[model samples]
Target: MRFSSRVNAGAMNPIAAQAAAAKAAGHPLGQLNDSNPTHHGLAPQFLPEAYTADPRGPLGARQAIADFINASRGRGVDSANAPAAPAVDPSNLYVLSSTSEAYAWLAMLLCNPGEAILMPKPGYPLIESICNLTATRAIPYQQFFDGSWALDLASIENALREGNGSVKAIAVINPNNPTGAYTKLGERQRLVELAKRYDAAIIADEVFYDFTLEPFDGNARWAGEQGVLTFSLDGFSKMLAAPHAKVGWIEVSGPAEDVAQAERHLDMISDDFLPMSNLIADCIPAMLQEAATQTERVAARVRGNMAELHRLLDADKQSGDGVVDVLRSEGGWNVLLRFPSSIDENALGLRLAHDFHMNCQPGYYFDMQSNGFLSISLLPEPTQFERNVQIILEAVHRELA
Candidate 1:
C-alpha cells in the first residue's frame, strides 16, 4: 500500500525522542527547555460554569480578545505624542485549537502543493513540520546575530527572487523563540514593502508578544498594519499560561477587500474543523482580565533567571576565561548560551542529561548555524533553574579543563 509522501515526512523529531526517552527512564530530568506554562505551575483558573456552557465558543470570547489586544496596543503607544491606536475588530478574529492549526489553515489558504513560504532561520522547527503536513515548501532566510538578532532582509529578497514566484507568504515570529528579539518598526516596514513587491501575505506569530522585557514605544500589535495582507496569530497558551486549554486565534487585516475575502475563506476553513473547546472559550474574558497577574509572575521568573545567569557568567569571567556566554534576549521563554568552540551541541546535551541529569535543547534544534550553542528555558522553577545553571557551568568548566 502506497502512502502519501507528506505523511512519511512527518516523523517524530529527534529532540522529542530524546525527551521521551528521559521521561520513560524515570530520570529526574532538569527540564531547561520547557515551553508549556502548565509545567511551570502557571495554569489558568476557570469558573465552574464555563465547563457546561455552549459548545460553540461564545461571541463574548472573541470580543474579550479584541478588547485585550486594543488595551495592549494602547499601552504600547506613546501617550505624549502618538494618536490612540484603533481597537482590533472582534469580527476580524477567528478562534482555533492551536497556533499550529492557524499556520495549517494559512498554508492551505496561500499555497498550492509544492509552493514555498519564507521562514526565519534559527527559528522554531514547527513551521517546517506544518509545511510538510500541508505539502508546501519551507524556505528559510537567515537572521544574523551581532549584539542582537536582526533580520537579513537581503537574504529574504534573495529567497523571494529565486523562489520563481512560488513564495506565497513570509512568516515572522515576533520576539522569536530562542532568540527573543522583537521585530523593529523599520524591519516591519521593509517586510510590508517586500510583501507588496512580491504580492505575498505576512504571517506574524506574536505568541510571545506580551512578554517583552524592555519598554515598547512603537505599535506592538500587528493586526492593524496596512499596505499588506497580514494574519497576526496569538493564543491563550502563552498569554494566560493555558496551553491545556488549546485556544488560539488569527487576526486578519489589510485592504478592506482583501481582508473581507480572506475572512470568508478562513470562516469556511474554521467551520469545517470547529477546533476550539467551549469550556476554555467561555472563560476567555476572565482569563484575559486576569492575564496581567499571571504574566507578571512569569516575567518575574524569567527576569530572576536571567539575572542569575548573567551573574554566573560574570563570576566565570572574573575567575578566568568564561565557560559560557549567554546571548541577550529581549523577550521569550528561552535563553541561548554559547560554549567553547570545541564542543558539539548534541554531545553536550547528552552529557548534560546523562552526567548532570539535566536536559536542554541544542541550538541546532532551532537551526542555529554553530555547534557550541545551547538553548535553555527560562520558565523552569526558580530553584531548579539555578541548580541546573550551576551544574551546566561546572560541567562545561571540567570539559574545558
Candidate 2:
C-alpha cells in the first residue's frame, strides 16, 4: 500500500532511537531532561509516579482490551448468531483517544494533500469533516437501498480508477450508521479484492457491531480480517454506552509485510501525539469489566425501542393507511423512517420540533438521496420512544392527507 509522504518523512531521531534500544535492552537510563510532573514525583497520589510513554498506549491497557475483544468474538464458535471470529493480538492494537482521532491518523498515514479516501455516502456525516481537516479529499461511493442497503461495488471501482493511485484507503462503516446494514461476506470479499487491486487499505468501523437487531445469519466482526491491510475500529463510546469514556482503538491486521510497515508508521504517529492519558488508561480494565453488562443493558434499550417503533407504526398503518414506514434495520442505535416524498423533510422536521415539540434528525443530515426520510434514534426510554413514534406517524399522516 502507498503511504503518505508525511509518514515517509518521519524517522526516529538518533537520541530517541538510542534511548529506545537501551530501554528494550533492559538498561534503564535516567532522563536528565524529563519535564513531566509525574516523572519528578510532583504529581498527585492518584497519578503514576513515573511517566512511561508507550506509543501504542500502555501495555496493560492494550492487554485488557485485547482480552475483552477476543472473548467477545470467541463466543458461540462458528455460529452465525454471535461474533464467532478469530482472536486479537494486543501488539497489533493502537489505543487512541477516539475513532475520530484514528481516522485523522489513518488519513495522514495514507493520503498526502489532494490524495483521496473513499467514504460511503448516506454514511457518517463527520467523515468528510475529518478528511477536510486532514487535507485529504473525501470521495463518495454509493450505497443503494432496495429493501436493504448494499454497496455499489462498481461505484467504488470507478472512484479507485478515477483516483489513479491518489486514493489511499476505503472506509467501511460495518453495520453502517442510519442504514444499519452489515457488510455481507460476499461484499467483504469483493472489497478485499478491490483493495488489493487498487493498492489501498481498509478502514473498518465496527463501533456498532454488538447491537444486532435484525441482522442476517453469519454476520461477523471485521477485526481479524487477514485479506488486506485492515484497521478495525471500536471503542467504549458504543460498547460501554459511555460517551464520556475517551478510549478507542485500532486493531491492525493483514499481510505480514503490509501490517509491519503500517504499524511502524502508525507507531510513529501515535508516539508524536501520545493520545491516551495514563489516568484514563488505568481505568480501561475496570471499564472493560463493565463492558459486557453495559452492552447488554444498552442493547435491550435499543432493541425494545425498535420493537416499540414498529408496533406503533404498524398499528397506525393498519388504521389510517399511514405513509410512514420504518426501514429494515439490522443493527446500530439509529433507524431510518421513510415517509412519502410529497412531504418535505425540512418542513416535517420543523413541524415536529416547533409544533409537536419533538426532535428528530432528517435523513438528509445523513445524506439520504431523497426527501421525507428521518433518522430516528432507538436509544430512548421505551415509553418516550413510543410517544415519539406516535407523533411522527400523526405528522406524516397529516402531511400525506
- Which candidate gets the maximum TM-score versus the true structure? 2
Candidate 2 lDDT, 127-172, residue by residue in tens: 8999999899999998998898999999999999988999999999
Candidate 2: C-alpha RMSD after superposition: 2.3
lDDT of each: 0.79, 0.87
TM-score of each: 0.83, 0.94
Model 1 residue 257 distance off true place after TM-score fit, in angstroms: 1.1
Of the candidates shown, which would achieve the greatest lDDT relative to the real structure? 2
Question: Which residue pairs of candidate 2 clash?
Answer: none
lDDT string for model 1 (208-298, tens) is: 8777654345635566776788998988788777778678888888877878767756655665665466565767787787778888788
